[model samples]
Target: MALPSVGTRVTYPAGDLIARARVLHVEPVATDDGERLAVLLDTTSIHPVDAGWPDQPADAGVITVIDGAALTVLDAIVAATDGETLHLGRDIPVRKGTEGWAFVVAHLVDAGSAIAEGDEVETRADALLRASLSRGHTACHLASLALNRALADRWTKDPRRDPLGSPDFDAAAIASSRIEPNGSVDRYRLNKSLRRAGFDATVFTGEYGADELRAAEASIDDTLATWIAGGGDIRIERDGDLLTDRRQWAADLEGGTARLFCGGTHATSLADLGDVRVRLELVDDDGTPTLVMTTRAHAPS
Candidate 1:
């Protein structure tokens, strides 16, 4: 089957959960559990988990065919192709926007499914799940900024600054970030590289370490609470509707407006985040000390 030459248009960035689209292509793909069908659509509202940064998982949803049949989407992933072969998720070789390559959203379904190319379909993402994930994602970003501010004094040397004008500790130290329903966990490494960069990790060790950690957590919570109470407007800005287009998350906070390059969906405003809090922990990662920040969002009723 011929593949799409252009990147798939996406609507998830705008918080869209449902869309009508036409099937552009279908290819059988081999997986660990055997074969599955990779369904490509001309446009999709489903938010596929990115291979490059799999922080937020794919949106759960189903596709309804014109004949009244509905097929559950087992998984949705970012797939890329050069018109000859389809590469799904982590298997993608080149970076997005590579010359002559098309980035698309591939909805994985049962192998023997009846979905086919040229078929008209209705794609619907679970609204509740999307909303929950959006809240979590927004909370995650806010917590990162608050954490940066909380640790600003620890940076002895001048380093990069975040959108909020604090030393960019989150960007410099983040190892992994996972967004779950109503919450997120971010892990940061405090190894020699960070120490060399003038980040004082000693504040997380020794007798007074626990006390210091608690103070930092308290500071982050206070900041988050104030931001949420301010109820600032939040939005995602994008260069285009295509999957590979540049996108950013922007918010108006008490300090000022902040923007960061991000591709995940987020809550419409700070008020939607409700009460946000964060817990901090220091753990040993293979003899190296690591910092874990867990943030939770309690949406207002």
Candidate 2:
């Protein structure tokens, strides 16, 4: 079968939990666990884990046919091909949107499965898991914005700003970000490079470090509390529906509307994220000072 010429159409961004699709391609792949079949679809509601910036993991789901047994979707990952070769996850060579490359979602199923190309199927993502992840992703962004606002005054020089006009400390020093169920964990590198970028790292290292950290955490919590109380509407805006299209997380925040480029599912409103808070701690990673922010939110009933 010929590889798809265009990116997969994704509907998860709109909080879609189910999709009707046709199998475009299927390839048997050998892995450490066992042989798995990679099923490519014409369209999907299952969210795939992006190799680049894999903060949020793939959605848990299954694919089925009419009155047929469901095939458990082991995982969904971003894959790309150049007509001649299909690359999966970290194996993808070129950046997204490269000319003549088709980026698609590969849903892995167990080996020796009965599914085949051209078959009509239904993709269903787990509602509870999706809701938890959506809430987590939304809380992740809100926490990062709050953290930036809390540490805005710690910059010694004029720095780049985020959507809310605060210093872009999160973007500047971020080492990694991971979204968990109902929460997120983000790490920031407070090294010489960050100091050179006008960030006053001493406050996080000096004798008053503990006190400063507490104050920052408190401030962020307060900001989050106010934002949640405001009950802002959350939405994902996109230019197109293709997998490679640009998308943004736009929220009608307290002060103003804030939009951040993102490629993950999210909650529908601030009210969906109940009681968001963060705990900040400093850790030494091979002699480098790293600040970790652990965010948590009470699941909405």
Cα lDDT of model 2 by residue, 35-99, tens digit = 89999999999999998999999999999965666899999999999987789999999999999
What digit string (tens of lDDT, one per residue) describes model 1 on residues 76-195?
Answer: 999999999999999999999899999999999999999889999999999999999999999999999999999999988999999999999999999999999999999999999999
TM-scores, in order shown?
Answer: 0.98, 0.98
Global lDDT scores for all candidate models: 0.94, 0.93
What TM-score does candidate 1 reach?
Answer: 0.98
lDDT of 1: 0.94
Candidate 1 regions with alpha-carbon error over 4 angstroms:
none
Candidate 2 colliding pairs, count: 0
| Colliding pairs, model 2 | none
Best-matching candidate per lDDT: 1
Model 2 residue 166 CA deviation in Å? 0.4
Where in model 2 is the C-alpha error above 4 Å?
none
